[model samples]
Target: MRKSAAPFLLALALPLAALAQAPVQYSLAFPNAVHHEARITVVFAEVPAAGPLQVRMARSSPGRYALHEFAKNVYDVQATDSKGQPLTVTRPDSYGWDVSGHDGTVRFTYTLFGDRTDGTYAGIDQRHAHLNMPATLAYARGLEQRPAEVKFELPTDWQVATQLRPDANGTYYAPHLQYLMDSPTSLGAQQRRTWQTLGRTIEMSVLHEGTAAELDAYVEQSKKVVQEAAAIFGGLPEYDFGRYTFVANYLPQTSSDGMEHRNSTSLTSNRPLRGAGALDNLGTVAHEFFHSWNVERIRPRDLEPFDFERANMSNSLWFAEGFTQYYGELLLRRAGIYTDEQYCQEALNGLVGAMLNSPGAARFSPVQMSQQAPFVDAAAAIDPNNRGNTYLSYYYIGGANALALDLELRQNHKTTLDAYMRAVWQQHGQTQRTYAPANPYTLTDLQRILGEVSKDTAFAGRFFRQHLLGHELPKFDQLLAPAGLLVRRAKAGQASLVARLSFNPADSTATVGSTLVGSPLYQAGLDREDVVRKIDGQRLTSAKALPELLAAHKPGDVLTVEYRTRGGIRTAPVTLAEDPTLEVVTYETARRPVTRAMKKFRAEWLSGKAKSFYPKPQPEDKDVSG
Candidate 1:
């Protein structure tokens, strides 16, 4: 996209009416749902008498930071006046169409092509329509504050599920365009459940070809997740839309994704809810539910008025997204959905693979990782880069950093991270205040809050400088020591191999994906993409063969390896060494003795017994609803 555009001059037009219409209206019909398309007509009830009125499709949407170029999905646009006379509509760009000579009422119709369903994209099919408003509706220029109403025309049995305020006539109302886009509407056969607690209502509407009993069980567990998340924030934030909705679509053809919104969220997966992969959906649920306050409210100022024309970038995503990722898993454990051992395994995978063992840890910082989000955060392209060797995901780094910071607060200061998070919520995300790009918290603000919460400014400065800005990571073995848990290679005490290679069936060759930075493989000129053709004069068809050939050999054996490099076929006489890869981490608990203080810290951090729920849960020994 070009960095500059024509100056917007809609204000130069004269007002045709004494007062603007109350709500800019949109009428949507899915008569051709069988063809995977929908007909949408938007009415700008109060257009200026003359000058070009700009109506454009968004280039991106909230909770997403890529250039989607939504205009590509729209076509066959037609415009007219209220009296049915055709109006001249000019195409200014791929995303915009300018209209003139409207009698204070501008109406346009367009066909939208939607076949994919995810948290960030819109999908329309014969059975249902998933609306991410930015991808579904076009907004008139300079009228962002205008209230809007949406009317859907579809099968009578197909119910409407959204966070928008519903009117008696079946239309939905939004205070402004921002709220409208933030509200996603799911129309189809929905299995709905509502639970009221603490003077607020939480709703779940699932669209799947599954039994209702599984949904009931899911709703019961979700209730516990909600309770635990609120306990961390002191209380749930004020939901301006009167409720928080969880809209999930689990179908065989749908894509998997979970996107967070201000008052609602979309969760989709291809796994069967009652079959083997059912439990996977619960993790995305725990993650998005916590976002009702994290990025949705305690947002990055730059992402506030979410840009629909370009990518929205923020340096604070390490906390905005990473800290949220941290609590998502933590809340699941606190709710008793995940056992202590299970939680430890989750920690080991992220801590070791993302921070400790990852070669990128020595090359990148959390801030640098967050800056790469626009390119890697679910980007559509499939180009390969140095991710395995020179890059790390902020999700991993941030989550690990959050875990270390949390354990440090509990172990050394006898304080918890929950109190600090609540302080942030109260100051940045409490009431009806809508944050914008100009009003976000900076890195300085985060350090200030940490200092205030920990009552140690010097500690805050040291933590950020040494651990955050630097490549060094927090020591997890020492941190996990307090929980009576330990992490080691899953192959430890069994095998002596650590090399990792992936096989390509198409070429019948093995390729090295990762190896110890300074190990023998690195010293022998085995680059990442070097195709291994043979080892010790033996043919190698699969990566499995490498381990089999070396099974009889001990450490410190010199061997000849032949492979194809980018330059050409080459043979290197490399010295064989013990494998140095930690493929999987083993998390063991209750295998060691636990001290009294260690027991207390684990109890308080792992379980929310340190703080009580608003409506206290049943017996402390009871597990979450099964």
Candidate 2:
């Protein structure tokens, strides 16, 4: 049985009176920003003078599922009262401080050190300060419903790019704690562009050393992506304030990342917006922007009212993130970024190949894989793990499933995934949401929607049971046939162990990385760290030797193998198997017949959807100020 959404709604139902209380105010100074440090102060007014007021940094940030323990970078903690007198501070837990003798008010201060520029962490330097709010700010526990206001004491000539509503005197406001934490800020010398579309404003603010012409060119391409994504949902989600921003930092110092927020997405990349890197960077933009509707609004029940104190777990990311992943690339094709079926076919090949061959996908369902985000989604650890054997990314699994469902719907139901997504948006996403999503969806809700969309409840039930909950892969070979695409073995006659080999030139030995569970090498008792000395009594001289040896033989051939392991040297007979890898190619490329129906299906599925709409006139570049 699933948990009811009633309790979650009740907990989030805030009274209008609580919002009038004095907000938690914060001031961020960067005297030591050149050295990667920020001095932050927060004041909690109207403290009840109860036992003690607790103030703490967040353990996790929005859109990130792992426990980052943001408090690790905080130091030199101190507290004071309204009159500048020091207060008694006690460490009640590792994440926060408790202050007494406050007289109904407590001012907390801390020095934070950060040097990484990405979506989940704070990166501060002389050039810029990239702040993900949860990584940079502290909040009082009981004041979650009160208003929040912050002012940035930025360096000279530096400006801010964020989704936070601008108030007078360089201050920004959020309705409550959740809204504040969901806003990310990029402070630097930024180049800005804005355009009006579908009765809303869309802006792209980029902080890069590139020329103005380059930024303009990037924005032109980004606009196509934005329009295509919006067309999928019928229109853009009513963004907070009727404006959406893309807060981007693309510099050599910035790490490659993209995070989705309510009104904006934090995009950071080290790649320059030129040549191949430009197209590569646009892929991230396509993915994150689609999240504006899929995840940011059509939210998951598990991730609603996100907890800042621990990891947020969700079972529906397969659809939330996965369907978005499928569309991220598909939309790129629809926007003319990818001009050929070959480029698009590569994406399908990779998705199908991994899901079909990976042991992890064979063992776990999409729901189980979605739950592994806490350990795999940008999570950090030192020890080695067997994730290769046990886990497949929800992105790939979900994307593959999306491809199947879309084709199935088109062929059998006389509809498309686009129509189903539009249904979901109208039902779950297009609600009247303010500080947070008012109508996050659950698994049960999705099944019902699928039933309604297809007009066949039995098909929806069977699809969910066999493909989502059951450990079974969709039949891609049959699904792709309708699109004039063929899924065939990449190397039909080749023999492979399917295990990675690291060769040592000098010693003429190859150390096995991780042997596939049931491959010939594994059946012969060879595993990771085992050294292969000779195959069929031929000493290995170079990395190419193994491939050359395998080329001479076909599947079902048996050969003697010699290898060294921790136990001792041994010899065994191994039975080779055909390479199970699959690849997708157009029928024309494969010299196969393509029917008229196939041609029509491919065109209808991939052609641009937003081209019929009249182009919106571009506005002049706006100079953004903090």
Candidate 3:
């Protein structure tokens, strides 16, 4: 049976004077069985005098990547007035409904059969049902800023869980309509677990057929991630603490990704825990959780008072997603999940990938990437050379830039990004703080904020304009040299042991039919058709043993590799050049002062560690032109 609600705060009473102007509440009852119809009832408080009130599904939800015309699932919609007179409804857009000529309190009812992929509603079979709101339900236009109360009615054998605050009589009150729309609620025969941290409660709801052991492990790890993240961010916000819900649907032939929302985020992955271990999961969780501070609350002007029907364009995704990405990994490192080497490797890997793949890196600016995200799918198959050239991802390149600036700031001020972010929390994250519609913090505003914390206006201004807005790639080699790591090509004739390989496998036998261009093997003249027979004289029978063989040699080492070529057996003696293309920045204890300063400077100015979030304020009586 569905769990009963515990006693909680009472719902905020609507102002009596505004009752006539308020819209009626809507209730939706979603059944647990897949393909079973779900019913929705909307009661209008008062009908309009001229035209009937209209209701429509959202074109898209915040943090989601795709356009979900949510109204597609709706069926059998009916409307009636207070006098029991049937009202007429017509479909206007692919996801909208237009009600005709009603002037009294009207009740609208509809049934929906859910089949969703990216947001809100999901159905695989009779065994599981997932529903994420905002993407599933329609909100009243112009009333999106008002407070709301929600209730869920699930099957007797099913459970309903959400991060929204609970109210008296089992109903929940969203802090505001935006929160009501952003918090996704899931219902089904799901396994649920709860944890508390920093005076806030965390919940994990997995809607899979996995065993209890698996479910419990997933929940425990999720809690650990939350705790670790809170430690780095200086704890969660006490005023509006909310839960984090994980709706794991173990579907075959699907990939893993997540969408962040206010208070909660919905994640879809093939296996709840896979790749990069617990720390990797922790970083993922941290990235999403940090959004509560960065993107969800401290938003750009275009995103605030969001327009749900269209794309909200702004040249600030680099700050929103990119900085959040940097923090995600940084928080993990600070929490001790990743060693210095692992963290360096991850950062270098991302930078190398972006540099090698982004063809438009020199042409299209970060601003363009942020503004064009609504149209491009970075993961889709396209021309390889031009894939990222004209289509930069604010998440990747912007993140690298942010990380560079963050590290630079840390070195210069002898502090960390934690300090700057704390300032942002104090200034913009307060519940009482309301950002202006168009006056949201620009690049200058960010620099001012950083100046307040560090008193380094010059450094902040240079970093923001030259690296972030001007599109100058940092001198990464110099940045890591101070840490005792040198960036150089492996000596010729010295074949270093293989550090890693990027490949896409099609079969279980670990046969590499294709390899990523610029990968070690690809640079070593290992063609796409070459069947690997041996490495360093060891028979290359399985993919697992290749790593051990590669680890035997240092940066400068020669290897005799044998593989099957189309013509015949082929032998190649390849010298590893420190994998120069594979940029790895590390720390060294001893270095000359000049080299150290260069490294420090790179870390401070070029590593994307600039302290400013926006551009600097101009001088009085000086006219600036872009």
Write the candidate numbers in order of decreasing TM-score: 2, 1, 3
Candidate 1 worst ten-residue window by lDDT: 5-14
RMSD of each: 3.9, 3.1, 11.4
The residue-by-residue lDDT of candidate 3 on 1-626, one tens digit each, is 11110100111244444433554465767653455566777666554466646576776567743455667777788887777788888876677677776766667787767655334454423554555665556654434434556666666776665666677777666645556667766666666666655556566666654567766655555554455455445666543544555554444422355667766776655554544433444566668877766877666766665555654467788788988887777655544556656766776557644743455555666666677666653223344343322666788777877666666666667766667777766666544332222244566677777777667888777777776666676665655555555544323333443334322233212233444444456567765556666667876545556655655666546777776678788778755534334545453422334466655644443232211321343122121110
Best by lDDT: 2
Tens digits of per-residue lDDT for model 2 on 198-296? 777888888887888888788878888988888787777788877899999998999999999989999999999887778888888999999998889
lDDT of each: 0.77, 0.87, 0.58
Candidate 2, position 131, lDDT: 96
Please report how far candidate 3 places residue 315 from its true position, in Å. Answer: 1.5
Instruction: By lDDT, rank the candidates, best first.
Output: 2, 1, 3
Q: Per-residue alpha-carbon lDDT of model 1 for 1-626, expressed as tens digits?
A: 24422222232132533224457899989988988798999988767676877898988788877778788989999999999899999998889899988988888899998888887778888889888888889988766666789999978778888888889998998877778888888889877888675567778888888788888777777878888888888777678767888988888778998889888898889887764456578878889999998888887766666666777787777788888889888887888877776776664466555677777777888888888888777667876676767777787888888888998888777677888788777766674443222245677888888888898899988888877777778887788777766655544433332456777777767887665565667778888788888778987766577678787676677788888989999998777665443432222333566678776767888885324655544343232222
On TM-score, the candidate that comes out on top is 2
Superposed Cα deviation of residue 452, candidate 2 (Å): 0.7
**Which portions of model 3 show Cα errors greater than 4 Å?**
1-24, 117-125, 145-147, 209-221, 239-255, 274-280, 377-385, 433-440, 486-626
Least accurate 10 contiguous residues by lDDT in model 2? 1-10
lDDT of 1 at 244: 85
